[model samples]
Target: MDWIQGFLVFLSGICALLFLFRKFFFKSKLANKKGCDHNCDCH
Candidate 1:
């Protein structure tokens, strides 16, 4: 049970790190588009 809990904690930490990186360090191309509300097949 301890090992299982540790594994879950590790996974949660990884997920949180990835989320933070994506939120702060990475930017989606579509998000930078102007006057585009839906998928415009721009790329």
Candidate 2:
């Protein structure tokens, strides 16, 4: 029983860390629009 509880807690912590990391990094990458024009000065 104790080991199961500990495993659950560890899994929750890993999930929370992944969530925060994606919120900070992956979210921004998804929000930005890719440059479509090859000759655009914005590149």
Tens-place lDDT per residue, model 1, 1-43, is: 9999999999999999999888754345545654445754334
Tens digit per residue, CA lDDT, model 2, 3-34: 99999999999999999998867545544555
| Residue ranges of candidate 2 with Cα displaced over 4 Å | 27-43
**lDDT (Cα) of model 1:** 0.71
Q: After superposition, how far is residue 32 of candidate 2 from its true place, in Å?
A: 7.1
Compute the lDDT for candidate 2: 0.72
Best by lDDT: 2
